[model samples]
Target: MHRSAPRLSRILACAAVPVMLVAVGCSSDSGSDGKKNAGSSSSGTASSKPSEPTVEPAKFTDLPDPCTSIGKKTIEDLVPEAKKKGGTAGGSTDLSVRGSCSWNGLDDQGVKGSQYHWMDVGFTRFDSDQALGSGAKRATEDYGKQVTKTKATEGAKKAAAEPAAGIGEEATLVTYGLSKTDEDFVYATVVARTGNVVVTLTYNGAGYAGAKTPSSGDIVKGAQKAIKEAIASVEKTAGADASSPAKDDAKTDAEDTKKDDADAKGDAGSEDSPKSKATPKS
Candidate 1:
C-alpha cells in the first residue's frame, strides 16, 4: 500500500506542470495583443496632428505707376492748394506719385512685408449764395472732428491733420492714407472729393522693411498725385461756369422777388399776380 501511494503523488505532479504551461501561454498572447493595439493608437495620434496655416506674400508687380497715369498733378499739388486755402501740407518725407505699384519691405525681425498704393478723388458743387467760406468752414469742421475721433482710439498713435481747401466750393479733394502698424510700412492713399468722387492707390505686405518702408516715400507721394488727378478730372466733368447753377438761380429768384415787391409798393395801379393773390371771394 505505501508504494502505491508514492506512485499516485508522482502522477499528480506531472498533471500540475501542463496546467502552469497553459496559463503562461494565455498571458503571453494577451500581452502581444495589448502591444499591437498601443502601437496602432500611437500611429493614429501622430496622423491626426493639424498643419499650420499658410500666408500668401504680396507681389510688387501688382501696383501701378502714379507718374505716368496721373501726369504732372500729384500729391505735390496739395502744397499750393493748401496754401491758397490758408492751410498747410507738411510732413517729414517728400511724396511722389506713381502708377499702380506694389513693393516689399521688412520688419524688425527681418520678415518680408508688402505695400499697396492707390489714389481717390472727390468733388462737390455749391451755389454762389452758399459762399466758398461756408463750404470751407464745413469741410474744416468735419476734418477736425474726424481727427479728434481718430486720436481718441487706443491704438492710434497720431491723428491726421485737417484737410486743406481745394478749388473752392466747386471742388474739394481729400486724401486717405494707410500704412502697416507692426513696422513702419505705407499701405495706400485714397483721394475723396466733396461730391463723392474717389480714387485710391493701395499697397500691402508682411512688413515695412520688405517694401523698403524707410525709403519708399512713394506711398504718400502717389496719394498726392492721385488726388490731384482726381480733382482735375472732377473739374473737367463739372466746369466752373456750370458747377453751381442751382445756387445761382435760387439767389437770382430771391433778388427778383425783392425787386418786384419794391416796385409793386411804388405803383398802386399794378395788381398782385394770380399766383401771389389770396383766394377769390365765393
Candidate 2:
C-alpha cells in the first residue's frame, strides 16, 4: 500500500485538473455571453438614456408678498378708514406664486353723505414652461384677456382703454364710471407687466351719503403711482437693478437712434465713394 501511494495521488490530480478546467471553461463562456448581451442591449435598446426636456428659466423666480408690495403710506391714503391698516390679505391658494391685498373704507359724514372706496392689488407670476410658453410671453397673453375683461364690466359706462407708457413693458389703463348702490362709482384698472410678473390694480370709489364722488382723474393718478410701486417691488424681488422702466426705454431709444445714424452715415459714404470713383466721360 505504501508503494502505490504515488500512483493514487497522480490519478487524483489528473481527475481534479479536468473538472477544474471544465468549470473554468463554463464560467468563461457565461461571462463572454453576458458581455455580448449587455453590448447588444445597449446598442439596440431605444431607451438606453432618457433625455429631459428643457425650458427657458423665468426672469423672476418668485412673486413679491402682496400685502407688502405697496407702501404703507399709499394704502393709508387710498383707504383712510381701512378696516385693516396692513391691508386685507386676499384668499390665495398659493402665496408664493400669487397673492393679493385689498383695502376698503366707508367714510360716513351723516348729513353730507358717506364716501366708499375700495382698492385692491393682485400679483400673478408665470413660470417658463416648455409645453406652454415663456414667462414673459405668457404674461403678455394673459394681460390682454385681463384688459378685455375689465373693459366689459357689467355696468361700466364710458369705458375706455388707452395704451399706457412708463409703467412696464406694456400697460393698459381701463377707466369707467358705474352707478352702484344709488351712487356714482369711479373705476380705474391698470394692468401692468414687469418681466414675468403681472400686476393688476383695481380701484373704485363711490360717495355714499353725499360726499362728492371721487374724481376719475384722481383715481387714475393714484392707480398709476401704485402700479409703479408694485412694479418696482417685483423688480426688487427678482433681484433686478433699480433702474426705472422709463430709463430702460430711453436707453433703448438712444441705441436705436445711434444705429440709425451709423446706418445713414454708411449710406452717405457709399454714395460719395461711387461719385468719386466714376471716371469722367471723354
Candidate 3:
C-alpha cells in the first residue's frame, strides 16, 4: 500500500506538470499582450501631440509719412491760396502707424467773392494677428467704418456712397452737402484701402459772398485726384525710405573722406616740411 501511495503521489505530481505548463503558456501570452498594448499606447501618445495653429502673414510692415503724401501740385490745385501750403500735420502719437495732414484756404476774386476750400488726408496701418486676422482684412474693415462715419456727418444732406475705381485695391466715395456759415458746403470723402493701409481723404468747398457753391461733381473729382496721388505716394515713399539709410551711410562716408583729405592738406600746409606730424593721443 505504501508503494501504491508513493506511485499515486508521483502520478499527481505528473498531472501538476500540465497545470504549470498551462500557467507558463498563459504568462507568455500575457507578456505578449502587455508589449502590444504598450506599443499601441506609445503610438497613441505620438499621434495625440498637438500641432501649432498658423495664420496668414501681413503684407506691408511700414507706413508712409502723411504730411508729404500728396504732390505739391495736387495740393495747390485742390486748396488754392492755402493758409499752410505745406499742410498742417494732424496730431498723432505714432507717425509710423497713423498720420494726417490738412489744409484750408480762401481764394478771393474781389467783386466775384471768394471760394473756400478745405482738404485733409489721413492714413491708418494695421498688422496681422492670429485672432484678428490679416492686415489687409483689418484695413478693409476700417475702410467700411470710415465710409459709414463719413456718411453720417452732422447736417449732411443727400449723403451717398459709390465705389471709386483707379484709386487703390478698393475705394469708396462718400458725398454730402452741408450748410454752415449761411453757405452751402459740398463735401467729398474718399476711403481707400491699399494692402494693409487705409487712406481717408476729405475735401470740402463753399462759396463766400457772391460766389457760387462748388459743384458736387467737381468736388468728387478733386477728392479722387488727391486720394489717388496720396495712395501712390505711400508706395513711392516706402521704396525711397527703405533705401534712405544706405544712401545716408554713403553720404556720411563721402563726407568723412572729404574731411580726411582736408585735414591732410591742412597738416601738409602747416609745416611745409618733409617730416610728418604725430597725431595727438587722447
What's the lDDT for all of these models?
A: 0.41, 0.86, 0.89
lDDT per residue (tens digit) for residues 1-282 in model 3: 778998999999999999999999999999999999999999998889676586556556676777788889988998999999999999999887899999999999899999999999999988889888888899999999998898898899999999998889999999999999999999999999998889999999999989989999999999999999899887765432243578989999999999999998888767656455566799
TM-score of 1: 0.30
Per-residue CA lDDT of model 1 for 75-167, tens digit only, reads 333222221222122231212212222222222343544332222222222222233334334444444443344335334333243343453
Which structure among the candidates has the greatest lDDT? Answer: 3
* Preferred candidate (lDDT higher): 2 or 3: 3
State every prediction's TM-score relative to the real structure.
0.30, 0.65, 0.70
Candidate 2 structure quality by residue, lDDT tens digits, 52-119: 67766677878788888889898778777888877889898987678999888887778998878888
Worst 10 residues of 2 by lDDT: 235-244
Q: Which rank order by lDDT, best down to worst?
A: 3, 2, 1
- lDDT score, candidate 1: 0.41
Identify the leading candidate in terms of TM-score.
3
- Give candidates' CA RMSD values in order: 24.4, 11.5, 9.1
What's each prediction's clash count? 53, 4, 0
Model 2: colliding residue pairs: 113-209, 113-210, 114-208, 114-209
